[model samples]
Target chain A: MTPIDEDPPPPSPAESLRMIAEQREAAERQLSPDPLVYHGPWGVAWLVGFGVMFLRHGPGGTVLVAMPAWLPLAVLFTLLIGAAIVSGVLAGRTSRHVRGRSSVQGAMYGFSWFVSFAGMGLTLQRFDDGLSPPNVGLLWATVAVGLTGALHMAGGAVWQDRLLFGLGVWLTLVNVVGTALGPGWHSLVISLAGGAVMLLLGLVLRRRPAGRPNE
Target chain B: MSELDPVIHAQARLRVVAALSALPEGDQLAFPRLQEILGMTAGNLSVHLRKLEDAGYVEVTKTFSGRTPTTLVCLSRRGRLAFEEYTAAVRALLPPPST
Candidate 1:
């Protein structure tokens, strides 16, 4: 233990350099973002929202549940909006105290999410009267999920996280296959492949030690 | 010979400066957080931080968080330049790389 006033004897030249490197690395690790914080909320949102949608219908236009079709859509949108809000506020806190390149990048990425979703929502609404219920449903589901997958891929590339990029690719492929399979199955694929996989990843990876110790 | 800045040459203060320098310009860390990282007692860290503050090498801000008192520390602009100079001086002590 070092006394308050006593300094350690002068370190050797190599030792001094090593010490500096060690301290910088430790501090950076402690300050890095947490994966769980990023993944958990979205995982839950997709899983529950899509899972409900899957249960509301069955194969070959059979109605499995008596509830209105709007119920599942409402649940999915509500959960998705909730997930977006929670993630934004929590993630924003990390960059709140500092202003620099990383901070600017975070802000811009967040704005992109807002802008892309808003634009998609507006374009879809323009077709409200023209498109039939089934066609519009297909459009909304495919467009939203597709945009999410594309954005995830973009984010993964920007952050250089291979797992995230892979997940985006996985989501995109499953989304396409699910759309082709049709009639209640699209939601099934999304719930299981997209939502469940994310939840599993988010939960399992959460157990891995975070770079920073909790304060 | 390039001389080390005496204010930063001390091991504890050198470590504190090194850790703080990792933060981006104008960013700050709370006192408890710094102490936790360094594994130092509050008294030891406060003394070293005080010395760095006196030398115009670090900025220390004391304020209340809700009801509790909090100390926030950041390396000043002078401190960053001093650390850069110090690292360069330390490098000067080493022999040049062989081809």
Candidate 2:
């Protein structure tokens, strides 16, 4: 058993400061949470959701799967909703132990997500009546993914995480290319290029131990 | 010369205070989680924590998370002020930087 009664000599002033700095960094790491937890759910959601879409409407609008028309939309909505709920719960769980400016920032960020997505949903529904099926799919794909990328970049800026900001930019560029490819191919591109990137990054990050260089 | 807190002057308690102080105001950590962060054995941690609790520098709460009991620890407002003072005192001990 380690001796509790015995006391070590006090560290020098500089050494004492160093210890404090180290412990503070360690505590910050614990408080902030793992990035992998945030990324993994979104990755799976996009991969499965878009993968199904790609199968239902193959590249260049060629019908690959013979499933009922409603099945694709149903599956996609279910997965996206599930992922959103999980991400919200994870964020809440991690922040429940702490409070201050960061908590307020997180809450505002979450609200922004709701507001932006709600607006997108309303606008998409309004336009759904006017557009053809393929065009409708293209509209939803570009706008939703584009907004998601912009919001993600905003979040990254708020947190000052360069990697996350880069990922957001990558998502935007991926969608741009997917948009150029048109409807059916867009899903395939997003599933592989955007969603798969998140999953791969999550895997890589989880394997490495968390640390910050001394500052 | 007596600016340093005798209670916080001890190395183990100093570390405990420092770690707890890092938490945002009103934030807490599970006992096991704190022990893991500090790399201290359970018994040793309990001993130091008792000292801190006795000094009124930390609050230890016994609560149930589902069926299991959890001990949550947080630095009190008094403890935070004390840490700030302790830090100032430590800095005061060092000689001024040469031009």
Candidate 3:
């Protein structure tokens, strides 16, 4: 018969506490939210949604000759909403697998978008009679950019993530440029430039190895 | 002696509680995942987990994700409160910080 191995001596109380402290530190590092998980999908959604809106409303003011202006807006709304739902589900599932903290943070982030967009819609309705179609579109674009920028910045600050913070600053600048240049230029920048940036970010995030810290 | 929780005083159990406490409320870690993180053998981990379960510090769920059976462990509200109390007691017992 094989002899049984003897158990090792238990650690001293002080040693055990110290081991716990070390483990805690390691766990904290492991538990922090990975940017790619949330940001990748988020960026893609905005990119596609905004890109479609830009094509319809840019300087030329109608890419599809047969389609009505309202159709473009409708499409944009559908795409954004669809993206949000899909991304939310994906984030939830991924968090479950990884035991990640980003699920709550991502939900809060989505809430910010809902509030911003809904507020803009309500404000527009209040001044519906006074505002021109172009003016309304511009207001929509500006609000979207502003809110997105602010939310990203807030996320960056909360998470201490430089990439998110940088993206926020860039998006804020895009808003400034869009507001200054008018709706056509604004749409062009957001669709082409902003979309590209977001898409690039998504791809980069997708490629990043799991369990790696953003820092 | 007065500061530490008797249930949480042991090294393995303390590690288990600490790991669970780090997770968000309602989140559970699979037994294998917890074992990997805590660097313990399956049998050892199970024994410690059973101890925690008996103490009302953690709740374990046996569920299948597809065909494979999984044991997921989560800290209960009681467990969280106890951990908090234990930490506070430990802190109170510590010496004042030096300038």
Candidate 4:
């Protein structure tokens, strides 16, 4: 193994004892939480919040005359429904590595979300006449939201939690596809499909890991 | 190989060897658990573990009982000697307690 970033200089024995006490105190705080219930609901709440925000705006102004005013509602529903499905995945599979690894994985997921959004942004500029300055601004905000999802996922991964990783990937795909379709048919289909997939994945993640200790 | 003396030799391996030497037989600690107990991170714990294994002062066992892999550290006969020597050195370093 590559040698660790140089070994820390040894503290005086008394100092070492103090440090040990501090670390133990911190770890105790982490392990003391009701590991299953606490983190599971925490993950669920985040996804629910994401879903609520997507649906609250009640869709954007209609682009096609033939399309009903309610078309935006359909789009919003797809996104929110997808959010609900994936939140289940996040809560179920993310418990083991929650302490140290989740933070790093969450950040990485955020970066991936941005990269995917940037790709979608350039794609949107190519096709539609309706792509106004404000619309472009919305896309940027979507990109930021995607980044938040990614960070949460990455953080979960670092902590050795699959739920976080699954959610991160799910959100990244949603943003990428949502952007590529330019707020119309493509985004709707992708969101619905991804949400369905999350529903399935949550079932698998929630099961007990073979031979692992109980939480 | 680096030249080594019996006395200065065991100084570097002191803390970890001390910790493992104190454990009851067959109970092994995972890296993070050791880190918490010893107030060290995985990196620090692994480093000392490697050194102790090299000197035959401790035996390192890597195995997975489940999804998470485990690193088991145990004292070897030779390690038990080095630890005894180390304890002697530490005692030697200290002045006797006043009666």
Chain B vs. true chain B: TM-score for each candidate?
0.94, 0.95, 0.92, 0.71
Using all chains and alpha carbons, the TM-scores for the candidates as numbered come to 0.68, 0.70, 0.59, 0.31
Evaluate fnat for each of the predicted models and list the values in order. Answer: 0.46, 0.39, 0.16, 0.00
lDDT of 3 by residue, B1-45 (tens): 464567776667778887777666756777876777788999988
What DockQ results do all the predictions give, each relative to the true complex?
A: 0.28, 0.26, 0.15, 0.04
Candidate 3 backbone collisions, by pair: none
Which candidate leads in TM-score? 2
> How well is each residue in A1-215 modelled by candidate 2, as lDDT tens digits?
13235766366877777777777767766766576777887888788789889998877677787887678778888988887898898888767644455678889999999999999988788888898888898899899999989988998887777777888999999999999988888999999998889888888877765542311
**Considering summed lDDT, which 10 consecutive residues are worst modelled in model 2 chain A?**
A206-215
Regarding TM-score, does 1 or 2 come out ahead? 2
Question: Compared with the true structure, what per-residue lDDT tens digits does model 2 show for residues B1-99?
Answer: 764677777777888888887676655788887887788999999998998888888999888778988888888888888889888988888889999
Assess the local accuracy of residue A69 in candidate 2 as a C-alpha lDDT between 0 and 100.
68
**For model 3 chain A, the run of ten residues with the poorest summed lDDT:** A1-10
Candidates by TM-score, descending order: 2, 1, 3, 4
A1-215 in candidate 3: lDDT tens per residue? 12112322124544655665667655554555444545555566566666666666666565734446677677667866766777666646545544324556666776777787788777767765678877778887787788888888897776667777889899999889878888767876776566668768766865654332332
